[model samples]
Target: MPSYAYRCRGCGDTFELSRPMAEASAPATCPQGHEDTVKLLTTFGTVSRGGSGAPVAPPAASGGGCCGGGCCG
Candidate 1:
């Protein structure tokens, strides 16, 4: 089950619920008993690090290949 966030339009209440994916799009009732609620879009975050436990830096841009520079014409 995944948690879904919802906001009530009737009382401006926000809440979360853990439900099946099939019911993710289903209607939700706010804690205040308001049925006029809408599911809120959610975002996920990821954490990554190098083997040394340091934050990994993005790969540097290549200097353009065989020419060793952006001068291959």
Candidate 2:
């Protein structure tokens, strides 16, 4: 199930709901009992299985095909 964010116009409250994608467009009622609510556009984050916390990938090993093998020289 994916979580959808919504904002209430009557109470000015923001909330989230988890439901099936089929019912994503369904009407949402805020906790303040406000029927006037609109779904907010949310961005999904990417998942990285990398162990390092760095933003970029690790550098390649010194021993490689071209330069390491001295082919370019």
Candidate 3:
């Protein structure tokens, strides 16, 4: 299951719902029972840690191309 965020235009409320990924784009009703709701664009991230329970920084990207490698000349 995945969680989705939605905003209600009628009351300007924001809410979240947990549902299957297949229905992620389905219409949602706000807690105030407003039908004029639109799904919000949300971002999800994961932290890789070594059992320390501390948040880990995401992996670094591999440089590429001339400019990326500072070889543009």
Candidate 4:
């Protein structure tokens, strides 16, 4: 079973559900009993350790990209 995230448009509530992948796209009822719910895009976070056994931080975003005030052309 996989976990799915959903948000209720009726009450603005968020929730998660564990179900078969086949029904992952099925409509879900919110915890508050709202039927107007939609699945939310979810992301997973991973932790990496360095040689010293300390958690490694992610690299900083490059400042030369289109959204970083750099020319895209």
> Using lDDT as the measure, which candidate wins?
2
TM-score quality measure for candidate 4:
0.62
Q: What residue runs in model 1 are displaced by over 4 Å at the alpha carbon?
A: 49-73
Residues 1-73, model 4: lDDT tens digits: 8999999999999999999999988889999888999999999987656577677689988776667756665
RMSD of each: 4.5, 7.4, 3.8, 5.9
Please give each candidate's TM-score.
0.66, 0.66, 0.64, 0.62
Off by over 4 Å in 2: 51-73
Whole-model lDDT, candidate 3?
A: 0.86
The lDDT for every candidate, in the order shown, is 0.88, 0.90, 0.86, 0.88
Candidate 2 whole-model C-alpha lDDT, 0 to 1: 0.90
- Alpha-carbon runs more than 4 Å astray in model 4: 48-73
Root mean square deviation (Cα) for candidate 1: 4.5
Which of the two, 3 or 4, has more lDDT? 4
lDDT of 1 by residue, 18-70 (tens): 99998888889999898999999999977665476667789997888687787
Clashes of 4: 0
- Model 3, 1-73: lDDT tens per residue? 8889999999999999999988887889899999999998998877656678776679886676756766754
Model 1 accuracy (lDDT, Cα):
0.88
User: What value of lDDT does candidate 4 attain over all alpha carbons?
Assistant: 0.88
